[model samples]
Target: MAIMLSGHVIGLLKEYMQDLVEQARQETSAQERFGFAATVYRPDHAISDLLALLDDRIESEGMQVGLPEGFLHEIWSLCNQASVHVADRVYVESNVGSEAGSKARTRELTYRALLAFIEARGRASAQGEQGVMES
Candidate 1:
């Protein structure tokens, strides 16, 4: 029997157990058959522009912190690209296994990109919160 976890909990667990999860991902399947005791539940055929999501989030925060218009413009210009963003990669990876899919290698790259964004966002948000607390 399998038990499902909420996305928020899984994200938190993934963030916390990243190294352990990476080790699991790297382990060979010869003897015990490499497998996960747990995994993040990703959905299917998702298409979203997280640039918009992030922009909305930033603007919402700005309501309190007051970000500059130019800063928002620059951020938009950076993320508003033709290529797939980290969020898109993560979405695709979630639907497709990390190492098994149509474009497995490409998906892996996308997953990495998404992970990078996750780490960066974590750091940025933490700093933002700290600043709020300090001020």
Candidate 2:
């Protein structure tokens, strides 16, 4: 049977994440955070690194996501990316005016592409997991 996170669970998850981030925010110091961001990993590397950080944080914090006996990164990617995609399906918050049509449409398209990419990753991860389980 497939388990699902109820709205309450998601809310608590978000709150829990925010609390963790709040602690990090307090600890890092503003200059350190800026210096780190200004000269840190590239976008793709940052994406994977952030995902890994989140995985570690969730595990360390003992937040039970109720996933099956498999990799947490796979589960986290699906959940987080789906939430991002749904939130951006109408308009992306970060989209600025571009040469496409309008800032709004471009932002929507940009996030649509991101959603597709994340979904593709999820599919590939699932296939690989299936293969591993069968082996």
Candidate 3:
């Protein structure tokens, strides 16, 4: 059962990562042709708040007391990687100022990545709960 759970979690994480990469590529391509300004999206909420929500959901389901520390670390690491990728994309493709553009791109990518990760995790947890209920 633990192995199955682990496999499910890893699959979800991989899908989340692939989605982030696709998003980054699309954003980079858009910025390359036409200079685009960063706009605040609904999913650009605080990471802490998202994590708190996840914690609540996890507790309510009685599946686990807390998210695994390794999962948390991997999420953070992915966010950082996404941020760096955005920064590099903006710097290399955009004609904007170096420091400012890079900073803005980094911020945008970080928030987007966080939002994507949280949404994916939420969906996965919900599915898991549904499975438990059905069983």
Q: Which candidate has the top score in TM-score?
A: 2
Worst 10 residues of 1 by lDDT: 40-49
The C-alpha stretches of model 2 lying farther than 4 A from their native spots are 20-29, 32-50, 61-74, 77-91, 96-135
lDDT of 1 at 10: 33
Residues 104-126 of candidate 2 have per-residue lDDT tens digits of: 23323433444455556646767
Full candidate order by lDDT, most accurate first: 3, 2, 1
lDDT by residue (tens digit), candidate 1, 26-120? 54233236443333323121112233434565566644543444544543443333135655766565556655432223334443564455456
Q: Give the TM-score of candidate 1.
A: 0.31
Q: List the residue pairs that clash in candidate 2.
A: none
The Cα local distance difference test for each model comes to 0.43, 0.46, 0.48
Worst 10 residues of 3 by lDDT: 41-50
lDDT of 1 at 63: 44
- Could you tell me every candidate's TM-score relative to the true structure? 0.31, 0.35, 0.31
Candidate 1, superposed: residue stretches over 4 Å from native: 1-84, 87-102
RMSD to the hidden true structure, all candidates: 14.5, 10.1, 12.6
